[model samples]
Target: MQEKRDPLLNITTASSIEWGPCDPSVITNPALSCSFFEIPLDYHDPSIGYGRLALAKLNATQDRLGTVFLNPGGPGGSGLDTLNMLADILSSLSGGFYDIFSWDPRGVGSLTTPGEIFCFDSPDEYNVFWNGTVELTGIEMTGNFSDPNDVHALLAQAPIMQAKYDELARRCLRHSSGKFLRYVGTAATARDIVALADALDGPGSLVNYVGTSYGSLLGMWLINMFPERVGRVIIDGIVDPTLLATQETATAFHELADADKTYEGFLTGCALAGPQGCPIASAEGQTAADIDATIQALLKQAHDAARRNTSAPVTSEIIRDELLSVIESLGQAALFANTTWPMLVAGVQAEAGPESLTARRSTRSARRRTRRSSVSQQNQTRSYSNEAILCGDSIDLRRTRMSEVFGTVIAASRNTSEMFSVVWPAEFYACPFWPVRAVERYQGPFNKTLANKVMVVSNTFDPVTPLPEAEAVAALLGDNARLVRQDAFGHTSVSEPSQCLNAVMFAYFVNGTLPEDNSTVCEVDTDFEIFPGVNTEAILAAMVPRKIK
Candidate 1:
């Protein structure tokens, strides 16, 4: 009898990628090269066939040290796209010594397999489903959980959100291929990293890499899965592995603890910059507290309109979501979308009032009248890779009830900020509804004895990935990891355009140096004035505004 091979899978082979000119659609960087790997869908089992990943590399200009892999988070984020935009700058940041490589991780944005993760059939399907949801439309019903009336009003809608999410779970399952979806997660991607390292730098070569936000989680998985393979790894904007692996997506994770503090910093920065930069800033000694109060008043006015089922130019949910976005992008938000802080504020002035928005309210109400079950929906060639990857890694929450979600949301309000909590459902609320789980999810033993000390960089006031999470990871990894906190706001240290941060990173990668343990604090380019003015060099060196969040 002849030995039989698994028909669905490919045998693990020693493979190498051929770098060639990238397609104009995928990546238009003429200087960079593009290629891919035929990686096993299941690393441990060859029965799952092979999946392809799209990769891009920027070769070093000077004497090459080695290749350094980079991931820009999102769990589903496209490193290939990031490389295209920041190729020159990142190459320079690494001192033009190491080849910078990034890729479209499985199921993310690319024509590569497992393909783009989608819960729906098209943008129209999503827009229709989103019609009845609070995420798409700004919440006018209540401002926050301040008054009992508002709290009750918010809680009453919890079941609706839950019901909508439950249906969402069904649609995702109905639309997505469960077999391939299971492999489109971190553990497999981690294996792919090692495999890519093998192909690019010869088998078993130490992996040099940088990851931010969800990418940091992938880095942790990579380091732990192949401890000795870690060469020069930096995980910036760290995620709380504890919350990530075990908890359901929306259960008051530690990541949001500093969100409000980061927001306060934004308000203060606006006041400091004055009216020229921040529209809502007071000219007469306007304190951060005063600006916050003005925002609160605006929300209240929006709430009154919402109470009457009226539509304003901006709703409470929209403003609250924007608040969260601002905190996540405080550095880049200094000049976001060609609109400064003041202009954004002026737009949300509640100038039109409730009655003025009455005409718009009728149209909004008519569109929202379509109930969930009333229309039959179909799937589209779309992707929500973040949801797929994140929910798969997390412990399942199908058994959860509305009360638990309600309590969690309420407690989350206390934990982060009342305004932020209202907009929480947008990201992780549907995770419980995510039916697919990964084939392999790395849960614990994050403190593996690595080949080197993993450098963890973070912003002190990071809204999403907070500094304490970085501290905890550093403490957990013990001698295997070192933590460096840049005294700045936003999601990651690089967003602040700090020379100190960049120099420290370069030194660590090039010279194998970690900053003095607790004493490491890089200042923002704005405060110190020590870096002179924000020049082209500084902007290029710092992270591109599109952040890891």
Candidate 2:
């Protein structure tokens, strides 16, 4: 018997598209045009409703090869925003020969569009959920015990975390509309991609795409579900679909372990760079090893103080939060470490006296001001949308008990990664009580070969999606995929400035070229150097490719 084809491939109606200049304040590009295209909220049931998915297009300055669809990840990331922000760099990378296009998926971005997912009615409510007076809110749900050896404290706090999650879940369900939540999964978003392809590229045309981080998950779903429509796909920062699809304790442990390894890499890298290369390195005449030992001692001091509820300025919570910030931007660690490491040191030194503590507080406040603005109101909606999609996409959390989840997290903290164990497992905190599930989720035959070879990129020491996960994804996709191993410390390899990596990617996107070998490893360009004390603006400017006028 023949398999049923996706009806979206047969869609004949042309999408009503309008192009207008983007808001200059938001996107300085005068040439960039933004628009909205209507797609069915539930692709399986057109009767449900139609919603507009926001899109932006930057036509190639020179001759265009074709259109390349881009997704920046986040599960809730705004592809439209990505294109707007990186138009010049992206166009340059594509050799000024491909039109770059991206969209904000349903339930993300503006509520003015149909099918916006809302967990909290207002930003104030969302802030309360994440950073309110509640003791068991936000990061508190996963108690900030800095030492991995603090197993007793972690275990004791597990029940409290579980209870808080339960309450949070109940609150989400009470606040959000059930109808909107049901259609926010990655599978549905994949279908939407197909619909957009059908409309823009003509009916039944294969999709040419690039996705990073969580966006890689979406790409995997698209190719597996609609293999015939796959074309020139690159899944960078690959997420392990097998692990993500299930409720496995081992998977959670492995992810945190990966994060811990990445953190270790940062410390090692900083030490090797020494005093001139790394600001966090040991003082004059001291070895890098000495610096590492000092950091460990300071961390211990802060941990003990927090445990004792002392008046010490540096608490476990502050340490954990700072560490997380560093981890998130590990790709730019050579530059980021200059500021973050100093801040960390300041926090540790604060225990010396009231004067030191006051200075540290002032420095922290100034740093906060210099940092990017808090998540905008639209981003709050995006955050909730991310939760809805993740909950809907993964195995039903309701099947597992909250205690089991908490226990697993505690066990991971104790056995695998004391420093980062809470990060991944904590994401599951509110999942057990998620109010809705996707009406039609994709249970994959993920092993199927695609119509075209897919390119998979992984960082050697990615804090989030690690090397093993990318390798697993490549193995799962069989001969239809090739893994590009980037020897760098970062979440996504493509976004990092690497000439060799970019050359490989460019060849594939422009000329359909694959690496000569099944597995290709690329090294960082030695010429690209990041030094301590370089202006942050200069660092960013150096990273971005020069745009062709």
> What TM-score, over all chains together, does every model reach?
0.85, 0.83
Show the lowest summed lDDT stretch of 10 residues, model 2.
Answer: 365-374
lDDT of 2: 0.64
**Candidate-wise lDDT, in order:** 0.69, 0.64
lDDT of 1: 0.69
Q: How does residue 117 of candidate 2 score in lDDT?
A: 54
Q: How far is candidate 2 from the true structure (C-alpha RMSD, Å)?
A: 7.0
Model 2, 153: alpha-carbon shift in Å?
Answer: 3.2
Residue 420, candidate 1: Cα error in Å is 1.4
Which residue pairs in candidate 2 have backbone atoms (N, alpha carbon, C) closer than 3 angstroms, thus clashing? Answer: 148-418
| Per-residue C-alpha lDDT of model 2 across residues 353-458, encoded as one tens digit per residue | 4465434432332222122111234433314555677777767654666557667766766676666665432344556667677776776778877889999998
Best by TM-score: 1
Model number with the top lDDT = 1
